[model samples]
Structure formats: C-alpha cells, structure tokens
Target chain A: MNENRKHDSNAQDRTDRDWDLLYEIRQRVIQSVAKNMDLFGVTPSVGRLYGTMYFHGQPMTLDEMRDELGMSKTSMSTGVRSLQEIHMVYQTWKKGVRKDLYQAEEDWYKTFIELFTTKWRKAIEINSKEVSNAKGLLEHLWQNTHDENLKRIVAEDLEKLQHASEYYDWLSRLVESFETGEIFKFIPKKSEA
Target chain B: MNENRKHDSNAQDRTDRDWDLLYEIRQRVIQSVAKNMDLFGVTPSVGRLYGTMYFHGQPMTLDEMRDELGMSKTSMSTGVRSLQEIHMVYQTWKKGVRKDLYQAEEDWYKTFIELFTTKWRKAIEINSKEVSNAKGLLEHLWQNTHDENLKRIVAEDLEKLQHASEYYDWLSRLVESFETGEIFKFIPKKSEA
Candidate 1:
C-alpha cells in the first residue's frame, strides 16, 4: 500500500488530515468535470471515473480503477470503454505489464477536435441529404405545375431549401477544417491554452 | 382554408394529391430538424414543431401551431415556451393583432452563437474558479511541507491546475469573441453558413 516506501529515498510521513486536504483540493475539479461530462452526453459516474484517473496521472487497470472508485469491475470496464469511445481515455499496452492499462487524454483541444468534428460531419450529412431530397421534389413540382400559384409557392420553398443546402455545405467545410486542425489557424491556439 | 382565393387574382383549382406531394417534401426537412434538435437538448416533437414553423415562414398563434402539428394545445404552449427559452422561437406582435404570434429564428448561426457562448462561458467560469481554488491549496501545502515527496506531488498537481486555468481563460476569450461576432471575422461566416 505504501508506494512511497518502494521508490522514495526518504521515509514518507503524511498525516490523515494532510491527505484529506489533498483529497478536497482534487475533489473540486473532479466534481466540476463530472458535471460538465453531460455536455459530451456521458453520465456523471463515468465522468467521475475519468476525473479521478486524470488526477492520478498514471496508467490504470480496470481492477485498480474499481479499487479506487469503489465501483464494480463491470461498471469500471463499461465506463472506461465509454470514455475511450469519446476520446477521453485510451487503452494502452504497458511495457512488462501483463494487465492492459488505460490513460486519460490530457489535451482537451485535441479531444474536442477529434470528437466534435465527427459529430458535426454526421449531422451535416444527414441534414444536407434531406435538403437535397426536398429540393428535388420541390423543383419537380415547380416545373411540372401548370398553375401559376403552385409554381410561385413551390419556387419560394425551393429558394429556402437552396439556402439551407448552402448552409449545410458551409458546415461541411467547417467540419473538415476542424478535422484538419485548420480551424486553429483562424482561432489561433498559439497562446497558453 | 382558401386564403389564396381571397388574395390571388385567379381562383385556385388544385387537387388533393398536390397538397399531399407538398406535405411529403416538407416532411423530410421537418424530420431532419427534429433529429438535429437533440444537439440543442430538446425533444424531437418540439424540434418537429420548430421545423414546421420554419417552413411556414410566418408568425403563428399557439392554436394554429397545435392544429398544424396535431399536438394538444398544452403541449404546443410548453414547446413554444421551451423554444423561446433556447432562442429557437420568438414572440412577435402584428399590428392590432389580438392573439400573440410566435416566429421561428431562421438564422442558425445567430442561434448557435447565442446559445453556445452562454453555455461555454458558464463552464469556463466554473472550471476556472475550481482551478484557482485548487492552486491555492496546493501552493500552501507545498510551502508548508518538509517532505520532499509530498511537495513534489503537490507541485506536479499545481502545474496541471495552472495549465487548466490558462485553458479556461483562453476558452473564456473565445466565448466572448463568439458573443461579439469577433470570431466571424477570423473564421469568416461570409460564404454561406
């Protein structure tokens, strides 16, 4: 249990209250991260495990995670898989280690680019397809109709659909820029962040 | 039912099948919108109502919306209020109009800026505050501790918190730029979306 004894040159002596203070400090961030995980469509418990792993700053196995979080091993496994799927955590092969290990992705910007670009691209594809279909129907309706009133109404709707298609096209480009990291050229992630 | 007859110069003579065709066309967009509305954290039905109103391209009363969606009036009212809260729809007044009219906010870019900036800012504020508090506690512990191992651990944690704080600051600036439309200058929302 005493990792300090194994590696440290000096004998360690941290009081219970000192450990409590350290726990309290990280608790704030862990809670905050858990709350914000909702933004990424994850439950708070899964987010909490990620936050705990982030603070650990070490590769962890499912058993280690379960021991630390007091969650069931099954739950820990599911949580880690979910986090990995969202680009928040990754499974790693540790040298000389038999059990598979997992690590948290510390770079938030990289995670955002990877995750959001995929989601945005999917949404853009779905919406653009719908717009195209609607445009085809409206255009056909507009051309075939002998009635001027029907033509006018269909034409108006067609124009709106055209605008929506254009928007979807632009959004597709934006999604590409994100995936390519070209957006950083415009937003400039050069500073401390 | 025959507003076109009252307004148009000629009498209308369109079959029921023409109306069915038009409905089919709008159905695609309405379904697409309903699916995407999950991004804004609304139910599909509410999003469907917004999409229907968007295609209508005019201010409509609650009763009119209920009739169009075939939803109960109470459900319509709730959906309208939820849409208004998210800046997806707005209450508009017509000259001497008795019943209040609600219109969809068709500009998606404006809606994105308004909604996301507020949510991002709140997240930035919360995470930054937590980082500040953690930094304060760690710094104090590091200074007081004679144990080099404890100090080293706290120092490492402190460094992480500092980077996190900087990220939050940069994110805050990004949120403000979005709110002020300053980001558009760099990304250039010029072409379409």
Candidate 2:
C-alpha cells in the first residue's frame, strides 16, 4: 500500500513539473511573437494574447489569458478586440459559461491574406489619391505653361503619375484576387512548373 | 528693335511663371511621398528627398536640391545618405564639378526588388531567430517531460515551430527569386491569359 502511494506521488510530481515546463514554453513563444509584432508596428499585447491562445491550442477565457500573460484586464480586453477586428482571433461561446472564450486562427494562409491586404490596400489607396492630386496640379500647369523646357518636364511628370496610377490599379486587382482566393491560380504549382 | 525687346521680356515673364508652377508641383509631390513614407514608419525627409529626385528625373546636386526643396543642408545630407544606403538613389560625378550629384533609380522593377527584399528579408531574419528560439525551448521541455499529455502538446508546438521555420525559409527563397527576376515567370502575362 505504501509502495502504491509512493508511485502515485511520483506521478503527480511529474505532472506538476510538466505543467511548469509547458507554461514556460508558452511564455517564451508569446514573448517572441510580441517582439516580431512590435517590429510591424502592431501592439505587442495583441501578439502576446494571440500567441498564448495559439500555443494553448484551445479556446481561452479573457481572465485566463490576462492572468497567464500578466496583463491588465483592460489590456486583455482591448488586445482581444483588436485581434478579433483583424480576423486573427475569434470568440467562441461555451455552454453554461457567461464569459466569452477566444482562439487564434491557426491557418497561416488566411492570416497572411488578412494582413497583406489590410496593409497594402490602405497604402495603395493613400498613394493613389496623392498621385491623382499631384497629377491634377501638374495638368493645370501643363495647360498654362508656355516655356518649352518646362512643358517637357511637366509632360514627363504627368506620364509618371499615370504609370503610378496604373500600377496602383493593378495592385488593387491583385488584392481583390487574394481576397477571393484567386491568387492561388497565378501562383505556379511545382508540378506544373 | 523696341518690339523685339518687348517680346523678349514677355517670354521671360512666361518662363518665370512656368518655374513657379513647376516648383509648386514638385512641392506637392514631395509632400505626398512624405505622408506615405510616414505611414510605413520611414522618416518624412527621406521620402521627400527621394520624391524630389525622382520627379526631377535628372541628377541634382545637394545645393540645388536644398534650394529647390527648401530643405536644410543637414536634412538633405542625411536623407540622401539613407536613400543611397537603400539603393533607391545613386551618386553621379559631373564633369568639371566637385559637388556630388545624385539621381533616383528610374527602373521601378529594380527598385521594387531592392526595397521589398531588403525590408522583408530583415523581418524574416528576426522572426526566424525568434521562432528558432521558441522551438529550442519547447524541444528542451519535450525532452525532459515524462507526462504523455504534456509530451503530445509539446510535439504539436514543435510541429508548429517547424512549419513556421519552413515558411520563413520559403519566403527567403521567394526574395531571392525576386532578386534574380525569376518571379516574373510566375506572373501570368495578360496576352497569354
């Protein structure tokens, strides 16, 4: 009976140690993701919370995440909201539970599309507007200018703006393709290549 | 003779107006670029300097650029140095002139490859290191833990890390293909499509 008890205690001790190691590993992953997200100008907490959920491989409660990550409740709420906004995380309802549970979107391809389109499309929109603004001003100048050399330069500038506009349009189409999963058609498969 | 003199004066006035209009357009383009650069976490001055050089479509000396863009010599110098470091601008030596002249790279494809690879590769390098670090810690945990459930969880985490590492490697290869212009092969030609 004493031997059985000793074996049971040893098994319990091993389980405890395993839990400690798992927690340590999760923390390390969270820190790494937080650092990378900061480089991309994203708030670190968003990455940390997402990383924690991803490593846990299960839906986690906000309070669980807050305590595990040592983050304030407000920060946890804000981070989870932003992650959900970006489609990187989603809330899941548990039966008989009032608090919402969240999990990271584990598919990297979906995450890539979300992030790429969000950033590049915004950049394209801003740049396209600016290009049009500059083009308008230059076209007005081109119409009124009488100096031959200045007319030539203005023409060149207008052409550059046109080129930029065309590229932005093409990029917008590409982004649309990504959103629709049509981009996979263009990406040559190794078998076909 | 009096009529000839009047005609010359009128032409000079037109030239002055053209110069004024050109300066205005240049300023607008510079402002647009600076705004976009700020969005990408780059300094406004760097974008301003590059935009000025690109729109000018010719090599410009530091003093000339400073006068045209209304930038301080210090800002121009620093901005130009940074642009050159990124391979977006190149210095040219003018005959019978001591001041260094610089021009923006005219080829968008070359510029795109240089900029995209530089930024993305640096990001990949940093993220890859962090992923590896996380993987290392998890591997150590997996080796030490005797709990079957904990070992299974650790194995899954390790697989995720391996997948991330592989993706980063594939991205680095993609960057290299971009550098080598091999990416063009994958891009569907409109004519063929």
User: Against the true structure, whose DockQ is highest?
Assistant: 1
Mark the 10 consecutive residues where model 1 chain A has the least summed lDDT: A7-16
Q: What's the TM-score of each model vs. the native?
A: 0.87, 0.80
List TM-score (chain A only) for every prediction.
0.83, 0.82
For residues A111-151, write the lDDT of model 2, one tens digit per residue.
76788788778878888887898888889888887777888
- Over B47-124, each residue of candidate 2 has an lDDT whose tens digit, in order, gives 888888888888999898899778898888888898888788999987998888999877655665677778777878
lDDT of each: 0.81, 0.78
Pairs of residues at least 3 apart in sequence or in different chains that clash in candidate 1: none
Q: Which stretches of candidate 2 lie over 4 Å from their true place?
A: A1-17, A38-40, A186-193, B1-15, B38-40, B63-72, B129-144, B188-193
Q: After superposition, how far is residue B120 of candidate 2 from its true place, in Å?
A: 2.4
Question: Which lDDT value does model 2 have at A128?
Answer: 86
Candidate 1 TM-score on chain B: 0.84
